[model samples]
Target: MRAVACVLFILSLVWDSVRADNSISSLKMAAASWEGELPCKEWNCECAFKQRGCCCAATDLQEVEDQIFHKVMDLSRRVFQLGDTILEVLGGIRVAFTASMSHKKTCFGPFTRSTPIPYNLLTFNHGSGYNPALGIFTAPRPGLYSFSFSVYSKVQGEGEKMYYKVQLMRNGEAVVSTWEDNREDSEDSSSQTVLLSLEQGGQVYVQLLSGRQLCGNIEGLNTFSGALIYPTLT
Candidate 1:
């Protein structure tokens, strides 16, 4: 019985030795199969037989990180551009104007048709929105605005009819009017103030009605003015 037990133990050792030799042979064959082929296409890698997948994983991870970095940089650039655009829009929102008829003592006419009264004297034009030559105030932006106009006249002789009609015009339409048609006063003056909601490029001005004459404007009292109350942002 003792001899038989010793023999069984020896057989077990032999079986273990065979299994170890077969495992080594399998590993050698796998190495030989990948001897000429690269485990990773872009980088050199020394991989063990069981760890061959480790080579391409690191390269792939690096590529993914590079892509993520570029995406972040692009997003940052877009945000900066948007900020600059907002600043430019805010900087352009200013409007104010004050102007009057020419400083020289003069009379504005009785024309066959209604004519725009040219205010050639510029007191202040913050945004260059008022044009003296054209006798027009162009709105620089959408906003509420205040406008005022004054008309003054003196008849050639006492008891003569003081006949005049002047209107504040918006886009060729009358918004307000001031006139002196009665003979009670030899010289007369009138003024009007109005609040207007304007869009970009809207125009406003003063006009003399047809067959109406204004005189005795020596003091630059005949004036037109406007200012932006507030901007409407959307």
Candidate 2:
């Protein structure tokens, strides 16, 4: 169990480095920071779950962490190939992104129906699946993916609704939504996130309701992002 903890600690180092790059790296940090402490520094070394081999899983909370650690290991190995260092594995092995509307852009839409919202400002595009021109994310591979989007709008006039609805869709199907409609405020914002199972070439995107609007400035208030959580492939 301690060995598993140590392994997670090592992987966390990689996870910590590429967090800004993709979803998988972000999850790596989570794996590294999981609430388990490695009792042993060496892999396969006998570990004391509590006290010198006596910290038996039968009498411990730490063992729960132990179980989680092993799952983390299994997940990591699933993402990274056997014998590959975590960092090496991240080079093209992980997929993720965080992007936003251009700081210069003012609004998304007032269309009749929901339309694809293009996020032209890209803070990160680790997998290069997100298209700034089209406002679409085409999955690069099959896996479990995480996605999130935020919508914000400014009250432009007395009649302009301060809130709007934004949907995050996978393969054209709505998975979740962000609706911000506060008349008392000059600006309203909402965000939604979801984890999904996807196949290669799958697509995910954000759509703005017709006549509704999402606004952002150079600060980039409206954003969209996602990352590969775990590869389904062995």
Candidate 3:
């Protein structure tokens, strides 16, 4: 019994250096009956008995197991913290925005030819992407975006034709357009929506074609809105 206790002490000394990654080593001096376990491998049992020791007692061995568990738990916490930081960084770059110009009375008129209608009254500017002064949305990130606009106008009399036309413009190029010409109706309105993949710093705006007159009432029905659908920025 004394020799067994001496041998177990020697094996415990080897535990610190051999076990670094938290894996439990198999018992070398294992008993045939359910008494206790030894830490050394099965093949080296005779060498361990002759040189160092058998294995630690259950109480001392439990302390080592407890220490290992705590270390593994601490490692798990560090991993989780790193994952959360990455997610927060990723969330900050997800591009999204929605903006619109007001429904109040706005008019661009009486030009001999088409002109760009600058919608001046901004009702809602989410993400501050829409500029009421410049009437432009400069993309903050590269992504697939959806843009929509509505135009409304009316003539003074019932029989008069209303020429209301506008185009969705991207970086000075016309993309999609909407137009209204009255037959029986004095007031005409049209709306158009387009999906475009834009790069960072690209500009999009609603342009009132030259020679056409357009006006929207105080209800602020005329609006231009856009939002990022798929983000291209990391």
Candidate 4:
């Protein structure tokens, strides 16, 4: 009877060992078979353990998913904030090309031989009134930009002479100014170019300064043109 009992005990222990081994093998197979749900696959020990651990593993996976979702939401919000800031900066621009005229009186070209000049000739308060005041322009945008001006004058004896002055102003303050005083009456046209860093709602103008005994004014016959160039937001 004692021998019979020993045999039965041995059989029971062997059966339990086989059952444990089968369970572990089954967990590993399940882990390998699944390829879509988790961050890791075939070689993932954690996944295999989770498969064997049932409820405990499921809880861990849920926590990880929640964390990932929150991280994505945070990144999305950051992107939106950055876009809003860019839009705000773009909206602040307010620079534009306002007025342009010449001495021709007819507003046709920059050169003409008419009196009672069409456009106001810039003049200084000095005795000779030799120097001219700058023509006023307004800024359409608040940013760095480029601008250019052209002037044509007609000499009394010869023909057409051109002289030009360009200036950039910010809040009524002069930021840049350029002058060309070529006295050759034969030249039909003269121009000046300027690059400026300006703020929104700023102003600019052009002025023609007289040199020696020669007096000059902007030529406006049939048409006169002035332009401001800038880059629009992308």
Best candidate according to TM-score: 1
Candidate 1, which segments miss by more than 4 Å at Cα? 1-91, 103-106
The whole-model C-alpha lDDT of candidate 3 against the native structure comes to: 0.67
Mind giving the per-residue lDDT tens digits that candidate 1 earns over 1-234? 332333233334344445666564543444344434342343322342346444334566678899999999999999999999998876577688888887545567889999998899898997889999989999988899999998888887778889999999888799999988888898988899999998888999999999988887435878999999888763
lDDT of 3 by residue, 115-173 (tens): 55555765555456767777888887788899888877767665776776788999889
Ranking by lDDT: 1, 2, 3, 4
In TM-score terms, candidate 1 sits at: 0.60
User: All candidates' TM-scores?
Assistant: 0.60, 0.59, 0.59, 0.39
The local lDDT score (0 to 100) that residue 116 gets in candidate 1 is 90
Off by over 4 Å in 2: 1-88, 104-106, 216-219
Local lDDT at 62 for model 1: 75
Which is superior by TM-score, 1 or 4?
Answer: 1
In model 3, the Cα lDDT at residue 46 comes to: 50
Better of 2 and 4 by lDDT: 2
Candidate 2 versus the native: TM-score?
A: 0.59
Backbone clashes, each candidate: 0, 4, 14, 31
